[model samples]
Target: MGLGCKMISLEPPILCRLPPTTPTSFRTKTIVFSSYAPDKGGGAVSTGLPKAHTYTASFKTLGACKLGISWYPDFEYNAQGGTGAGTGSKVADDANELSVDFDIETLYIPPLTSSTTKFLGLPLPTFLKIDIVPQLFQGNINQESGKVDLEFLAKFCFSVGSVYKAPALLVKTVLTSDESKGKIRGGRGERLDEEGNCKLVGVAFVEPIHDFFMDSFLT
Candidate 1:
């Protein structure tokens, strides 16, 4: 008999039900500017140079979200939040400043794709992992509005069967927002107890994949 042929269909990613007690938390960090002044033509090298000032602030309990007993399908990611102190740097010409680091834990893609309608008897490689990690985020912080504007480029790589793709640039301008309040499982505002500690929902958004290399790998 000649080589046999078979057909296999691939489905899209479906929303799975998460446990009611799925644990998640959110935290807000604040950078406050206490004061500022412009150089009154007083800099040794240049006039109208910026002058330094003093500022102090802390992140209080903005809000939190907790899920009770319910049977709802949701996509949940486990994220931990806690309070700690770290030394930060600021230019001599600036007031208060804050620094933070961001990490991309995973890149999730919906299961189905146009090219993956059906598989013939021929075999194919199994995809193991695809990751895009950025080194640093560059942006400005608006203390008054409690917002941070940042961007970063993503480095991409993936493993398929025994072969691993070399890392390359895949994405950029991964902008994020934290100015809005967060919602819990039930879409309720975060609740605060007598103590300042509050448990809030953590949120992260993934923008469109830009590079064709990334798109091919995902599909």
Candidate 2:
């Protein structure tokens, strides 16, 4: 009987980069498996996969300035997914497209003060103060392109200490990272950056309210 020798060929493993996976539940999972490739020294090296991320925006332009009437001092708003809001999801059929919705209502704006709030770059009168109550802040952010467009609705209540308080001014606008044009007023916004900082600008039309105080003030 003659003994026969046979040779076997083994193929190298394939390496690929995968997109980040959306978290299905509160639990975090390892969404990506590391892909390894041989280096010049024949040692395996990993080309890391993308991971899901969240962003908190620090607004640089939160107020308006027009005809010497201005509202100054920027504010910070953190955008996160919660009970009524939707988390990031792929918007288009393309796997790389992702968009996140923000419906924030719990956070309150810091009390307005002369030191913080200014008019025409001059400090507001110490006796005068305003309270901002956010009713709804819903928006969509394109993750890849850094574009942001939001519908903001809030009430600005003016007060003069314990003496008097006026009816809330219902302020509503479509804030965006692009130019916001209106018949009387317009603004421009900046796109979200890597550090989650951007300037959101909007043009709001002030509708006449039935309240005597508000009407008188506007007129």
Candidate 3:
């Protein structure tokens, strides 16, 4: 009899980063619905309300601002599920991309841009506006179905002449290209119907990001 030997090869498993998540609800420690006339004697009222724009706002301040996020299909990868259960199919790490947008009310900005500090500091603007537009984010998609839950977290402040000022925090999230078809539900149980008109919009596949706000009154 002759002796024979055989060799076997094994493939290694691939690892990926977990998908990003956005909160569906939020709670506020302090909130107030306030109104003031920018020109008290002139009858010019400024309630910080948003005027038919791609932004969501609180009417308690000087103006309205918006935030948005978007996601796109990774047509290049198009990989099917092999990783695990409910993992579905997956787009390549490089194929998936994310975008963020911020539409800040210009009126809230100080006439002199130099008057404000670079970071959060004293003498803060009566109101601050921050805007972000749809832009690519650096990361990967772990799902095979290309489904994503997008979130835009914001903490904003409102100030009135240094006497009345407070912080407003919020978290906005939306499901992208899913069964819902990109419809967003607001904190107050409001639904954003018009795609372009909604303050936060999601497309392709989306995820979450954070924002900040502060307040101080100036005479």
Candidate 4:
């Protein structure tokens, strides 16, 4: 195994380390609709309302390069916004050479539920996103190398109207991509380098996607 054929777990990646700020239209944006809380123009919502929380979660992989874990698989989630998106970055010399030996799983419980405890084993509502940063030739973020090119983007989407007060409607989804890696250094800096090649693993929404507020919103 070498830089050209290393396995790295891929997981949720975020954009603009900030929380959603778009205001929902009271008439249209909001599902159930909420009125002003008396004189309190900014009446707070539920106390359990998550203040846009984020954390790092991790799993194990047998090898970084050369040799890989037999049963564990080479793809190990380094870190993420709770879903193993934090462990760090992975860079490989050969882009198409990296391979793994396992399936993917959700590393965190999204603020939204993946599903409800139903008789049909139905999944709850939830959201998922993944960010990928790759250092092409230069493979360095600190150095100005032309050998590697860094490219990154995040595929994000959330179940619309998942807000506690909102009347969940259609299974709405919004996605966008951005650049996470730029200025290729000698190799991925703080980012790690495994054996053979690396592909930052792959993204998975382990949690099932469901529609809880289908009656009022979907109608």
Deviating ranges (above 4 Å) for candidate 3: 1-149, 175-199, 202-219
lDDT of 1 by residue, 114-210 (tens): 2221123221234544342444434433333333333444443444546545444343332223321222232211222222222233222223345
Off by over 4 Å in 4: 1-12, 16-149, 161-190, 194-219
Span of ten consecutive residues with least summed lDDT in model 4: 22-31
List where candidate 2 sits over 4 angstroms from the true fold: 1-87, 92-105
> Model 2 — which ten-residue stretch has the worst lDDT?
1-10
TM-score of 1: 0.33
Using TM-score as the measure, which candidate wins?
2
What's the C-alpha lDDT at position 120 in model 1? 34
Clashes, model 3? 11
Model 3: per-residue Cα lDDT over 22-61, one tens digit each: 1121111101112232343665555675322121112011
lDDT of 2: 0.39
Tens-digit lDDT track of model 4 for 1-219: 011111122112211111111100000000010112223346656666334322122322222211111111122222212221221122345322211111123222223233311112333334422222221111122111212122222222333453444222111111101112212101121122331112221111112225453232212
User: Model 2, residue 176: displacement in angstroms?
Assistant: 0.5
What order do candidates take by TM-score, descending?
2, 1, 3, 4
Q: Between 2 and 4, whose lDDT is larger?
A: 2
Whichever of 1 and 4 has more lDDT, that candidate is 1
